[model samples]
Every structure is written in structure tokens, then in C-alpha cells.
Target: MKKIFKLSLPMLVIISNVSVGISQVNVDDRQSVENAKIVGQLHGLEGDTLTLSYWVNALGLDETSSYKRAFAPVEQKIIVAKDGSFSVRIPVYKKLQYFSLKSNRQKTIWKEEYFFRKGKMDDISTSASVPVLNWSYFILEPGDDIKVVLQHGQMSFSGTGAEKIKYLNEFKYSQNRPKSFQSFRGDSLSTIKRISYYDDLQQFGINILKKYHGRISPMAYQVLQADIIGHCQYYRYSSASLFNSYKDPTIRRIYLNIYKEQVKAKALPLLEQLSTEVLGLSKSYPLFWQQRFKVEQSYLLYNAHGDGVETQQASKNDLFEAVLNLKKGLLKDKLIVMNCSDMLKVFGQVQVEERLATALTELQDPTMYAVVKRFRDDFSKGQLTYDFTMEDVEGNHVRLSDFRGKVVFVDIWFTGCGGCVSVAKAMRDKVEPHFEGKDDVVFLSISIDKDKRMWKNSITKDAKRDPKLSYQRPGAHYSGDKTIYLRTLNGSDDPFIKKYVTNAYPTLMLIDREGKVFAFSAQRPDGGKAKLLIDQINDVRKL
Candidate 1:
């Protein structure tokens, strides 16, 4: 069985099992940590010196363990008391919280995360209200109280009124129309559309769009029209609405294009449009939270793929240039907080490389310092490559180099790797059928230990024989020797692995065939939302 570290613990109990130096893993099946209200005191213990400090979980449980703290950025957070005597509680039906650890001192440790799960209210020993937390195990000596709360604790999910699905229509009236265009002005309408994607009232500004596209895609594409101010009120609102789905690039492009056009078209309102659209994109895709858990669990084995603190901080410098250039607040923080990935990947591509040099001039950029720390490494010398290759069960001779012109999903696995097998099986059931004929991409699994006979035997035991997944990797390798495709190369032969070394089993490396370096790597290939993978593949198609 695969060990799922990043999961909702439906086995609720607010069970904060301590493992001396390891982190606390909170399990929840439904809701976020914000839903599980908490009020607590954080402490630190080194040699029996107990010190109380300010902390916050004012909204949820503080599940950060020693290992968990390594994966998250270091800021203020509720610390379990030193000496390991901390009050821990979990309210029934509460929202789970997710966060990683960081430090102001040493380099950022990437694989530490805290995910709290929900359980029944009557099952726990504490009162329903938030409880006081005083933990002791590791040594943390500061308070981490949040300055303000962004969300509140919900008493129930099945309640009526504001909590009910019916309450969405109320947001329909909150739209602030672009400054110049009159809603009724037919001459100002450049394009009209109806989208099925919008069904929420919280993004009420889009009500105008739905009203316009009464037919056609009124089902998927909610109405969003650009006005003189270049701001598509509906687009701005929809980006923040939880109803927004991740698969739609046509929509993300519309927002991106609108931002570009407004700036090019000249505007007293360009900043306003860019502000709404740019920050909105981050809200739509919270990349920071997306990989937090994986890093928390496997940082030493995986790559977090970004600069250190300063680099992380400077990257968000231009997110909402118009608004952030003028002022700083939640908008700025949200832009920097949520979009740490795009700042390095997609946005990095669009930027001038020298801008990185300029960002380094700031003296506080953690990226340059990080680069200096690894300056002798392969990435600095431009020697990095995704050099490893593997054959599929069909004996297709699929190498990472073979997919050089397109995007490649490189599954680094062995026959006995349960997580790897589970993900491949999942792809067959949950996703592969959805894209039955997509030939634009290729998926390959590379075995580290070279054993062709063992490989074939394992394939027979797995693909042809598994019952729980009901997945048969039908076709090649099974019919004859020609049916099985297997490639094996030790990490020693692969320069890519040598550059950024790793030892984790069943690692997933998403690579670009064009450049052939690793795009993203994960240990739990199928655990969380597949949006990150979906987004990368979609991005390639757009190119």
C-alpha cells in the first residue's frame, strides 16, 4: 500500500502524533483549516527553557511539525510549546488548513507541510469552540499570530442562508462596470459571449456577461466583455470565484489578452484592469499551496524549483504593477504568495533575463544568494538536462530525447513501486479515457534498476493481473517480445540526475521536449488536483 502523507484525515481526532523530530500530519476529508477555528499560545523549548510568545491559528489548527516547518516559508505561525506539552483539538466538520515551513535564518527547507483533517464534533474531547494549543516537542521560540483573518469558521456546510448554494445570487449585484462603456451602448460592445463556466453569484460582476450570452456557451463561458477602461468586470470577479474550473485556457488567455490590450491601448485605467486580471490569475491558480504538501514530505527527494526568499519576494514585484507600483497590501501579498511558480516558470519566460540581474541588485533577493550557494552546481553552468530515458511496456524505445519536440510526462519508476503503479492505473481510468486520442504528448516510465526479464514479469503481474484498479495496459509487450518496451539507466549515466541528485522512488518529472530540462517533479504523482499537470500540457498546446 502507498503511504499518502498529504491527505484529509477523515479519521478525525485532531490526532497530533509526535515523532520526536518529524512533523505532525493532520488528516481531513473535507473543508480547509480555516473552517476549524483555533485560539492558542505558541512556545519553544531548548534545554527546558519554556518561553511563551504570540501565535495564531485564530482560524484553524497549527499542524506544523519539525519536518513540516521545513517546507513552508518562515513567517509568523503558532508554535507548539517547547518541551512538547501542547493542547491539540479538532472541531467536527471543520475546514482543513495547509502550510509549509520556512526560516529567516538558514536556507529554505522544501519538504515540510502541515495538512489538518476534519472529524466529528462529538468524537473529540474538547469543546466545540476553538481550543488553546500549547505544544512541546521541538524548539520554536516566537509567536505567529495572523494580523487579520481572510475567512471565517463555518458552523455547518448544510446550513441555509449565506452558507447555502442559493446565497450566490446575492453577488450578482456587486459588479463595478468599466468606467467608460454604458451597458446598453451597442457601439461600445467589441465582442459578446456566454460561458458555462460561471455559475456563482460571488463573482456577481459576471451577471452582465450571462445576460449578454443567453445562448451558445452560456453554459461554459460566462459573459465577459471588455469596455473602454479595458476592464472586464466579469473576468475579474470570476477569477476569484471558487466555482472557476482549472481546465479552461481559453478563459485564462482572455484575461491575459485583455491585460495586454489595456496596457497597449493606453489607459488611465490600465493599472486597474491589470490589477484585477493579474492578481485574479494568482487567485485562480494558487500554485504555492498546490505543491506545499509534496515538498513537505519529500523536499530532500524532490525539487521545489524556485529561488530562495529574496527571489520569491522579488518575483511578485511586478504582479499587479499598476496597483502594487502605487501601493502595497493584500493584493500585493496575494500576488506574491499564491503565484511563486509562474514567477519562475511561465512569467520567467516572458521576462528579459537581465531583469533577474536587476532583481539581484536589490541586495535582499534570496535568489541570487541561493544561486551563489549552488553557484558551483550544474544549473549555474547550464549543464542541467533531463538525460534519463525509459521504455514503456510496449518496447516503443521511448526516451526523454524522443519527446524533445513536445512535452513529456516522465514517470521515474520501478515495477514494484506501488505509488507509480497506482498513478499509471489512475491515468487509465480517471483521465486517459477523457483524452482518448491525444497524440500531442507522450508518457514514459523509466526503471532505475535494469532488469528486462523482471520488468516483463512485473508488467505481467501488474498491468495484466491487477484487480483492484481493473486496468490492463493492453497492447504491446504482452502479446510478444515486441509488445514490451523497457528502458533502464542508472542515475550515474544520467547527467540530469547527477546535477540535481535525488533518491526517491516513483518520482514524476514533467519535461519539455523542446528544452529537455525538468519542468516539475513530484513523488505523489496522482495524489492532489492534477491542475498543475493539466496547466502545463495546455500551455504547450497554446504554443
Candidate 2:
């Protein structure tokens, strides 16, 4: 079935511990080991280097189309021996946590989530042949241990809690198989049919859970039940795929024209049913409030678009009324902030800033009000660009502030991103030639490719290419003139890139000479708006 209630788990690498000549811990003997922390050992790794990254979910700001919510993740990374036989202790939080094991040479990554109670040690062993290594068999006792055996494309788990883990894994595997829900097309499925399919799927999930209730933890069963119910409500009230397809204006308009009347007819009754269901569910569920707000926001956006009310055309009062109509609480406060942030992106910083200033007075939750204010203050124009030091192709360290007195156009990209590569080619052809000899303008290309070798290889290949485009220069890489500053993130997460909220690859930015941000998100070099870079440079010079 289509994944119901997808979890937002951001992978954050924390630390790396490499050990040699370390003795592997036997799973049978781990029961006697102190259960102070979670310890893991991997067996048959193919590569010389293995990376373990741990991620913890934190309540921070998450922005979607300029709307901020409360969800962020902190990650830490650790490197282990490639022999796949190293042991390390990981600190455990009170809540659930997630980690990943990545083989650099094999190009394989295994990710899994687990709950680590105090004084618990998790012993894991897997080989290169293991189809899955993460969370396959986890012994949950304070000091319990488990072993996973993978051979000939088959996997088996053994340990104190093996039965429970095996049952859970089998149930999850069955649920993940391709189902009819995956083929349900948004445009083809009627609203009633869509609702019916989701309801049927939800009932199926509940039945499965009931069948296996005695075999799983009560907490796990409750969480899964809540997730199933929330997903059903979300899909029934708001067409899942239809909401996502709104990114393309043409598709959005077409779907609206075809389904507007039907949606108008059925939306209220569906929403009413959803509201009643959400109100009946306890507040302890993770998706309880989130689901309600999601349905409400989706409904509002659906009606607004159908009525041809563009965000720009909608006044601040209109936005306020939309938010005010929602039930007052944390959800309403968050929705208000989200609406204001959306306005900020649509109506420019000044207008949205004023709107938020007015909203703070009416907002009940001080934390959300502070979050909105902080977003406004941080994203305002003229703020100093976040500085970062990255390694260039020649191994020279380049700091963003080094070009403080020159207008810098930064192209944030990676090696595998096709869009990023296309934009880079366009910049090299049409944009770079415009200021070939102008020392006041610098074109900076920063690659966030985690693989340093791949980054270097791509740069070397690009340097050799002499595209015969209209703006082709004598050499693609300036024949060693170093006109374009090429840098790599070098596997570390650069704060400078994150400061601009670069969720998309090939994010272009224009920084003014005074080390302040001119445009946090600029036009693509391949588009007609690419000329705006030059205009922005001229405008900054005049300032």
C-alpha cells in the first residue's frame, strides 16, 4: 500500500570512530556486558571505510513553500574499519532514535530506527550479502543482545527477543509489498472512490494489527493504529497525490477545472467526518494535531485556488480570517505562522514582516510567535551572508567572505544532480562570459557531493569540455586562469548552504559586495531571469 503517514526522519551524521585490531564482541556474551549504552558491531563489510550516522528528531522549524512547522533532526557521524568488525558505544536518548550504516566502496546504505532504553546494549552483525542490516533483530532488554545472519540472499535473526523482531519484520515486509493503493491515480480516481480505498486500506491495517496484537509491544501497536487512522483521514479529506501535483500550475489548473465541482460537493461532509474523528482520537498520538491541521490547510488551499484567489491577491485580513477560523490552540498558532511565512515568500519580506508584527499581538502561543519573528528577522534582505570555508579543486581553502568586496554569484550544487549540472553549463556558457575580465564579479560553484573523488572527477571532466555554445570561451576552465572559483563541501555539512534554506539543488544566490545577501534564492542561469544577475551586480555597485 502507499506509505501511510510517512515519517520525517532527517539523517544527521554525528561522529566517526575507527578502530583496528579490536576483538569482536560475541552476541551470546553481550548479556553480561553493562547496558549503559548501545553497542554495535558489523561483520563482513566490503569497503575499507564504513560510516555510521545517527539521527535524532528534534522539534525545530521545518519550512515547506515558506510555511514553517516544528520538525528538525540532529545527526552525528562515525567512521569504522572497513573489515566490518568494529565495536562502538552510542549514547541513547529517552525517545526513539535512528542510525545508518554506509559502505563507501559497495555504495550500499542500510538505515533503521530503534528504541534504546537506559542500560541497553544492541549487538549487530551483518555481512556484505545481507539484504537488510538495520533493525532486523533488536533485543530490547536492558542488556539483551542479538545476531543477524545473512546468506544467499536470505536473512535470519537470533537473540533474546528474536521472535518478536521476526514477527514485526515479517508483518512490515508484507505491508510494504506493492498494492492497489500505489496505482490509484489522482486524476482518474473519484473523491468517493479515493475515500473508500483509503478506508478499506485502514481497516485492513487495523485487522492485521488486531491479528498480531499479542505478538507485538502495546506501544508499537498503538503508534501503528494512530498512524493508520491519521493517514486515512488525511487522504480522505485531502487527495494525497492531488495536493502534491499542485506544484505544476498547468496540472493544478486542469485538475481543479475537472474536479472542482465534485470536490465542492463532497469536501464539507468529508471534512466534517475527519474533524469528528480527529476530535475523538487522544491528543497523545504523534499525528493527532498534525493530521487535523493538514486537512484544514489542504481544504483552505483547495477552496482558495478554486475561487481563483492567488496568494498575492489575498489581503492580510483574508489570511488572518482563514487562520482565525481554525480552532484556537497550538495548531492554530502554528497555522497562523505558516500562513504568514507563506505570505512572506509570496508578498515580499516587507509586507510579510509587517503582517507578522501585527500577528504577534493576536497570537496566543509565544513560542510560535517568536519562531515567526525569528524567521522574518533572519531572512530579511541585507543580512550578512553566512560564511563558509571549503576546499577548491586545487586544494586551496576558499572562504565565502574572501570575496567581500565583489558581487559573488554562488551556484550550490552536487555531482549527481542533473539540474545542477545543467545550470552550471549554462552559467559557464552564457553568464560567465558577460564578466570575463570584470574582477568585481566572481562566479562561485560549490558542490555538496559527499564523494570527493566524484567531485574532482566531474570537475576535471567539465574542465576538458569546450562546448561550442554562443558564449563559449577559449577554455572551459579558463585554461588554468581560475576565473571561476570551484569548491567542494568536502563531505561536511556547510552552514552557509543551510542558512539560505537550500532544500533544492542548483540553488543560485547573489551576494552583494559588502558581504550581505543580495538575493538568497536567485534565478537559474539557464532561464531568461539569468540576466538579473548582471542587473543585480550593477545595482549593488551603484549602492
Candidate 3:
């Protein structure tokens, strides 16, 4: 049997300090202070398995060498008892960070996030009687009893820091009001009206902060303030994209005639206002502020370069000129790496390599430059994909190398991904039919679903069957030779997934006949892309 090794608190403290190089305060000179431990008793959990994971910002390199931000999971699992109860303690490194608690049953899973702080114990509990997963957080200082009650969809806390949690709950509830303001209905509103609407929302958020003035912690209040500002900026940027409708020629012509210049006029002022607010909040909340800055910069750049077309078709000199124009900082360096990497993916290595080489010269941070170099080394084409074994819905094992000598189209997905389901439907309706008789081609669906039953249900039953609402199929049934196979990763944190860097859901990849990766990130199985996959397969066959 494989031995399971858990990280002790001391080990976690050492690792966290060493890996991130964050400062540490000595409490007694014998033990250095580190992450806070959260202990909780969960009652009325419907699932047999529970998963706890925290988010960390990770840099992802796509097939094009473009860098994208991904929140990678550092997860741990707990076993629930027969009476729907479990006790767990999780360590959190950041003072203000988010952690998810996921309960997995045979048919369904319940997941929710809780805010945490280091050097504090958060005792939270929830019951199945509550319609939603509502948590009551309380700060415990070494020697306090832990308990929380779920009443009428609200959590009641009685321990230390209870008032703060109550205020947080109220704030969360207030923010949950209808999001209809975000929706844009075909340019019914003028450009000025749209900008004013976002401004009003920003003011409304400020009013929320003022209403809860003395009730919440100062840190929590600042975080909420930053969140509101970020949301307002995002809404304005998103509204611009919606109003433009670049894909719809008729809408584009109509919008450009009336509101194009007016919208462009408002963009700079809005971004400038956001910049002032973000800069003010940067000292107290650097990460949140940096994230907001990144988004705003992306929007500004997107608008400046004719939306996306100019950037997509930009030459090496044009790309460098656009990148170098941005203000110098770690954020700007990251953005340049991201854009250059994206260009490489969309335009291919030959077209974007010169531009990437030029951009690398501008990168002052060794860590960021190393990320780009590692991505380039790992994601290059014609490289052999990481081989691994996974079990089919039945108890049988299947190896990736088993499909050697045949071209493989691998679909990396999970049960909860809606995009993955839609692509699966497309594969069933379109891609599968086109290659009905192809012997050299194969379709492999690899699900990283934590629940085995969900994976089995998806393949054996109709695509329309809802596992939550209906009965699940017992196991998958597939012929050995026809190329279509449904397989599941052994666990949520499977090494195979980490090796492939399969961060995005519904990621498609096409493997050459000799098991070498042809397209590291292939087109989704939707629209005419399915036909394109067939064409590529035929072209590969000839070669």
C-alpha cells in the first residue's frame, strides 16, 4: 500500500517561509510564528468525502508561449463519518485569504469558500437543513469551545470575532442583490448613461461601506472597498466590450457611427479614476491592488490596439513597440510576457519568436524571465506527451502509450465544467461521426472528476441525463478497438495532470501517430473546429 504522508504544522511553517521568502515573527525564540490553523466540526454533511483547498496564483504557459494567470489548488481531503460529521484543521498562510470546503457524495458535491486569517482559529459549522452552505466563523484564541448554529440561512457565531463575521455576512447579503445592471441590452443606453450607471454603482458600494462603519474589522472593510472598486472597473470594461459587438458587423457599424468616439473618450477618465483608487489601496492590499491594475491595463491595451485584431496581426517591431510603451514595473513585465506568449500561441513560434526575443530584453526580473524560458522549453511542439495510466469506468487500466501508432485527440476535463460537457456533446454529435471509420485516429476523454460515480454516469448514460436529478449509470461501456474511451484520473491532484500543466478545462490536444504532441492546445470540438480537426488528421496521415 502507498503510504500517505501529511505535512506537520512545523514542516508547513518551514516550507511556507522557505518557498515564498516572507518575513516571520518569533513568538518565544523557540518556535517561529507561521500560518494560522482553522479547526471546525462539520455536522450533517451529506458526502462521504470532503476536500479543502487554498488558491495560489500560478503562471500558465500555453502552446503559444503566452503566459496566463491560473489559481492553482493546494488541496487536502478528509473522510466523513457515517453520521454526516467530520472534524478538520487546515493551515492558512495569508492573513486574508480564501479557502474552499467541498463535500463530495456519489451524485453531487457542495462547495463553499471562507475567509481566513493567520494566528487565528476559525470554528465553522453548517447543517444540511440549511438550503445553502452557510458558514459561521469565530476566532478562537487557543482555549475556546467551538460551535455555530445554522438558522434560516444565516450563521450565528458566539465566540471571539463573532461581530465581525456577522457584519461580513450582512455585507455579503447586501452585495447579492440583483446583478441586472451588468447586463447590456443592445445599446439601448447612450455612452454617457452607461458610464454614469457604473459610477452610481460605485457610489452605492461606498454607501454599503459607510453603513457598516464601526461593525466590521478595518482590514475587512478595506478588502471590501478594494473589491467594490475592482468590480466597478470590471463592469465598465465589460460594458465597453458588450457595446462594441465587434463580431456583429451591423451592430459594429451602428455603434461605431454613434458611440465609438464617445465611449473612447470615457475610457481614459474611467481608467484614471480607477488608477487613483487602486494606488491608494496598494499599500494595505498589494495583491488585490496588483490584480486590479493588471485588469485595467489589459483593458486599456485592448482598446488602444483596435480591440484585438491589430495585436493579433502585429509584426515583431509592432509587438515590441506596443509592449515597451507600457509603464515599467513587475506588473508590466508580467503583462508583456503574457501578451508575447499569447501572440506565440495564436500566430505560432515562427511569427512571434522574434517579438518574444525582443520582449525578453526588456524583462528585468529574473523570476519572470525564467517562467517564460521554462514555458518555451516545456510547451514546444513535436515533444512526446507525458504518459500515464488511468482506469476506465470499469475497473480496468488503460495507458496513454496503448494508443501508440495512432493519432490521439485527448480531452482534458472534469465533471463540473460546463464547457467540457458542451464539448463532449459536440464530440458525440459532430467529431465522432466524421471519424466513424478512421482506424488511425482515436478520441480519448480524460475526466479529472473527484467523484468516480459522476465520471461513470457521464459516459454510460445519455449526455442529457442529469446525475443530480436522475439515476446514474453503473459503469462505462466502450469497445476496445474503435478509438473512443472514457477514463478518469485517480485523484483530484493526480500527478499526470500536473505533468501536463492542464490548468484550463475542456483543453483539447491532438497527438501525432507516433505519440508526439502535434497541437498542444487544439481547437474545441464546436462549430467548424471539429471539421478542422479531421482535416488536420488527414494532413498528418499524408505526412
Candidate 4:
């Protein structure tokens, strides 16, 4: 456990590191001055049952994949031990919700909002308090229960800015949840002793009449849809910014035997077609369509991580319409798919109105739809509407709609883009002073090059030739919520250069808090990948 960020004036010196005895109960007085607490031990990582399909890749939360789930008021649980050993807990509670609790307690799927409290016992040296910004606290209340062991580290990494995240502050541990250590799964077709568990529920079309449409029942949507496409990315590094582990046990048994033979033949006709025609969870998909299935199965990572022998030039219906367009979070078509969280919320409201025909008519779809809305308005909404407006160095008009209820990145670039202003000044002198001024988040920036006064006098007289900077949080921009961010950038006509006609300049876009849009990139955000976007804005401020 290690997190730190500095920039004190009125506030912003985050500094997170704990473990060596932990404690925190925090009922939430707006998060009791935040009450920082860090403790590790996925218990004794490594699989045997409660790997419970590794809880959406260990709470980084992914119905698709924008990434988040580091560790927050966590309260996770698991049981088994006559002497076998395995009883985990993490109490801090009062965050939104998350839990693979091991994928609904390894398919026991009860979820009264996280469970396990028979007579609540303890003694794995009892004491678990997790509450960092990103997700990992596993919140467990309602009849609360505590007791854990199964620990973790060998350095479960993350770090950023002032340059030494110490590789994300090495609070290290590991017995095995590196996604269970031995299971290579890029997208899944089958694994776990000869496949058959609903074969990724009809490649996530989840049919049996649309698997009970959101209220969930066709037996809890065939057990959380075969625990999210046959157990969420085989486990570990579920994103909340950056954590990518691969360890190869033949590539985690070929991604758990092609996600256990596509969740035993497309998880009950895609949960009966989203329990017959989308009632809830609408018609979406992705927890990671591997960046659009590596651009149409870039030959399955070049035929198993590189060209060894075969290369028939892609066919088997183009690899089953590229694994059904990476389970519908992509594929402009062989039959259509696109849902990656509604194309990252209409491509972040069509790049705040640089209107690629209203962001391809709000990402509706028409096959190569304006070539996928000019490739998501020139790669993720032109570095997030590069300079729709600006003025910083503290004069502060700033305005990405004043950050609108939090979570905003905007982040375009060009100090001549190479190491892009030293990775944007090491993400603004180390992760924007560990989430500056202590609001939910706001990392601003936008300079496509019209010359905001030579980039505001090169960010106040060459702060080392513009090392990059942008941030927002405090009363979060401004949000009466017509979907904020300047009402999604007012909507067109110079609307951020009529959909990127100015062309790409280190784009970064990421927006949320009602403004929609969550990710887009022109490149260079890696101060250890802003520790997975500061653990997905500390897991959306714990939902």
C-alpha cells in the first residue's frame, strides 16, 4: 500500500501508505476527513475455489473496461478452512458497490449487497481496514462479519508523477491473486477442465430471453452471467488506472481455455438474449474489448503473443466476427456490436461537440459509421476537446464546464508532443499533487495549438518547456446536469474544431460525473499510467 501526491496551498498532499496494523470504521461524515487506511493480503492468493471467478478482475470493476478498483472502504469475504486456510475481510464500508466477493462468493451469488456473517468469527490476526481512493476495500456491512488471511503482494503495483511511485509504492505481497497466477486469458473460449459453462453466454449476447433484464432472476442471470464472461479476465489487475499482469501458464491456460469454451457455449444464449431483449444493462458489453479486440483480433496477439507458424490471413468468419466483436464492445459489424459502455457514452458526447455528425448521431451505428465516427473523433475525442477554451497558471477560468460534478481529464497536448512535455510534467508534477485540492478529481488541459497565448506564456514562463498540466475537482466544474461539461460542449460548429479537423495532438479525454465520456487517448499519460488513472479516480470516489 503506497500512494502520495503533493501541491499544498489551500490543499492537496494526498500521501497514502498504510499496513503494519490497520483500523478504520468511518461511518461517513463525508468520509471522515477521508480516514486513510491500507492493509494487504488477498489472503494467500492462488486458486482453489473462492477464486470465484476473481471478482471482475479483483474489483477494478468492468462490465467492459475503463478501469478502477484499487481499494476503498473494502470489506471483502471468503470462507473455507478445517485447516485448509482462507477467510478474508476488509471493513470500511459505505462506498457504492463491488465484489467478485470472488464472483458472488464463487457462484453462491446471494449479494444482499455483499454478504457472509453467520456468527462472524475472527483471528487471522484480525484487523482489516481498506480505504484508499481507488477500489479495493470490498465493503461488507449489513450484519457485518470480519476475519481474513490469504494475503497478497510481491508488489501489487501502481505509482505516478514526481517520478517515483516506487513502482506504485511497493507495499507488496503475494500468495496468488495475480489473477490466480497461472491462467493466461486474453478473451476466453474455455478453460477449467474441458469447457462448457454457457460458453461466455452466447458471446455476451446473454439470451435465454435477455437473461432477466437487469432485475436479474433467470437464476440471477445464470450466476452473474457465468461470473462475467467465464470469470472476469481470469483474475487480477482489473484496471482503476493501471495494472497489467500476464505471467503465462501457457498464457493462463490460453485465457482459461478460451474463457472456458466461451462460457460453455455463449452463456445460455447470452443470458437468453439479455433476458429477452435488454430490460436493464440495456444492450451493452465490455470489461475490456482489448482495445477493440486488438483491432479485429490482430491475429490473437499475433498468434499467441507472436507469429510462430499459422497466419491464414484471418478467416473462420474472420475469427467468428472477431470473437463476436470482442463480445460486442466493438466490431462496427460482421453483424454489428458496439457497446463499450455505449461507445464510452456517445464517445464522450461526441468529443464535447466537435460533432463527428453529432458523434456519429450519438454513436448510433451504421457499419463503419463515418468510419466509427472518424475513429472516435480522431482517437478518443481529440485529446478530449483540445482547447475548447483555456486560461490557467491560476487565472482560472479553466472551464471544462468547471469540471461538472467531478471526474474530468480533457488532457490534449503538444509542447511539440515527443515525451509530450515530459509526460505532461510527469502528470503535472506527480499525479496532480496527489489529486489536488482534495475534490473528486479534475486533471484539465487543452491546447490543440491555436495558441492560448503561446500556451499561456508556456505555462507561466517555461515550467521546463511545458511539462503538461490540467486538473479539476473543487465544486466539480458546474453541474445542473443536462449531462454537464458545458452541456456536452454546447454542441457543434467550432464545437472543438468540427470533430477534430485540427487533427490529433496528444489527446486524453476521460470524463464522467454526468458529463459522460470516460476514455480517449492521444498518448503519454504514463507516470506508471497515472496509477490506472489514479485508480480510476479512486474508483469513482467509491461509486
425 in model 4: Cα distance from truth in Å? 6.0
In the range 308-423, model 2's lDDT, one tens digit per residue, is 44422333436567666766654466556556545543444456567767666655543455455555666667988788888887778888888888888877766666666667
Tell me model 3's lDDT, rounded to 2 decimals: 0.49
> How much lDDT does candidate 2 score?
0.48
Order the numbered candidates by TM-score, best leading. Answer: 3, 2, 1, 4
Q: What lDDT does the true structure give each of the candidates? A: 0.32, 0.48, 0.49, 0.34
In model 2, the runs with Cα more than 4 Å from the true position are: 1-70, 74-171, 175-204, 211-223, 229-325, 328-347, 351-377, 415-437, 452-485, 523-527, 531-534
In angstroms, how far off is 124's CA in candidate 4?
A: 7.9
- Clash number for every model? 54, 12, 4, 127
Model 1 earns a TM-score of 0.29
- Local accuracy of candidate 1 as per-residue lDDT tens digits, 119-159: 11111222232122112111111121221111232111121
State the TM-score for model 3. Answer: 0.56
**Of the candidates shown, which would achieve the greatest TM-score relative to the real structure?**
3
Per-prediction TM-score to the true structure, in the order listed:
0.29, 0.54, 0.56, 0.28
Could you tell me the lDDT of residue 239 within candidate 1? 31
Identify the runs in model 3 with alpha carbons over 4 angstroms from their true place: 1-69, 76-168, 175-201, 210-224, 243-248, 253-325, 328-330, 333-374, 391-396, 413-438, 445-483, 490-505, 523-543
Our model 1 lands, by Cα RMSD against the true structure, at 19.8
How does residue 516 of candidate 4 score in lDDT?
53
How would you encode candidate 3's per-residue C-alpha lDDT over 1-543 as one tens digit per residue?
Answer: 321222122223211212120011111222222343433344555345655543221222111211222223345665655554555443433233333444564223222322223323233433333224432222212222224443443455555434444554554455443222322356434433555555666666677667777765555455456555555554454444443335565654454443344333543332244443233222222233333343344344445665444322333335446557766654455555555545543444344455556666776434445445545555567778778788875668889899898888887776566667677766776677777777788888787766666666666644455547443333232212343555555654465565454335666777888878777667665655778666766666665
